[model samples]
Target: MPKVPKWVADVLENVFSGFNRKVIVAEINHLHPFIKTIKFRGDLSGVNFKPGQAISIRVNETNFRNYTPSFWDSENGVFEVIFHLHGNGPGSSYIDGLELDDLVNIVLPRGLDLYKKEYEYHFFFGDETTIGLFKSLKQVIEENGQNYIGILELNEDTMHYELKTRYGLDIVSSSINKAQNAISFLQNLPDRVWELWQNGSFYLMGNGRSIQNFRKALKEKGVNSRNIRTQPYWVEGKIGL
Candidate 1:
């Protein structure tokens, strides 16, 4: 939900809390200055999670934020989510201040249909906010023995995060204009690389402007719009997306 009235949000929260699951924060790790990974333990026996799905948590009485789980073990009743604590608003502040054993009510995972197994090759393009989603997708793709390539725009300090190394995503510093930097990087790729990925599926998330620019570049390269999927996590000057 996007900035609803306080009374309306309260009513929705009451209804949502009926079926929402309460999870305890089990552990927290700071992967970078602004990146934190949190593990939550709870009874998730019947939860049906799909790659690229996000769980919504009420950050405040009138605001809710969605985050993608990086990994989960239903049998063990544990799941983990990586959060980029840009700290511009309540969601980041709430997540950053969470302490061990704190109870959090989270709505079940739900999101757009992002992953299509029918495609042999998958391409991902996004920034720090999309890391968790990419991580979840990478797990399923590797399990299916599918090929994938990804590029992420991250802060220079975050470039050394172990998760990025483990996921093997190409990282570009955010010091430059994000959308232009990403588009330039894609345009500079060799012809052979484009040949291999031209027919693949593309998943674009994170900044709305970046997705728009990247999508336009892909189309100009003769990639079909049908092959691209986009979910903007945020936009410049917007509180939530």
Candidate 2:
């Protein structure tokens, strides 16, 4: 299929304007030196959002970006999205420039369904961009009486502390190594956790290269390809995925 051009995207945005929800920025929290969380309030009724799904936000006339909600409150019409301000791209600038009461347009959440009930245990891997998805999964896993373990590789040292203190996510853990060191981290998975790989559902996201490396390492460890799901949000030297 031919790639759609920017002009077509703009036209489609206008044609489907009715599907867009108007949201207000309710709050902002700088979780780390490189990460920020934005709270949004809008009419979210009638939308069935899955744990790992993401919503596309219209950042400007010709730019749209996908963001996974950290949590959703259908009754209250509120949710949160975490952003990694690693570059000066349009998405980063738009998120950074947001203030309380600022209005934005976002489409409904849709993406891969990672919260599988068939599996007894799940193992999640990602970087800063995976934080929101991790948060979404943790809640559903606990509610469903299932087990899950998250190993996130973040470049910022403060991310680990913030995820624990600010977010109170005890089930998810983190490493200080940059995303490039994901292979080494995956290779050194503790012997105690190796037993969980059997019959485990693996979810990998974030940096594309790192996700590929982790997926390969998991396969080398005898994990079935059917048990692994990956979504590469960004790639090295690439604008987006």
Can you write out model 2's per-residue Cα lDDT over 1-241, one digit (the tens) per residue?
A: 1224679877877898877889999999997767899899989998888888888876765677888888988778999998888788878888989999999888878877778778878888887888889888888887889887666776645445456554443323334333435556556768877787556998888977777777877888889999998888887666646
How well does each candidate superpose onto the true structure, as a TM-score? 0.93, 0.87
Instruction: Work out how many backbone clashes candidate 2 has.
Output: 0
State the lDDT at 208 in candidate 2: 78
How far off is residue 159 in model 2, in Å?
5.5
RMSD of 1: 1.7
Candidate 1 global lDDT: 0.86
Q: Which regions of candidate 2 are displaced past 4 Å?
A: 1-6, 156-161, 164-180
What is the Å distance of residue 120 in model 2 from its true position?
Answer: 1.6
Residue 62 CA error for candidate 2 (Å)?
1.8
lDDT of 1 at 171: 77
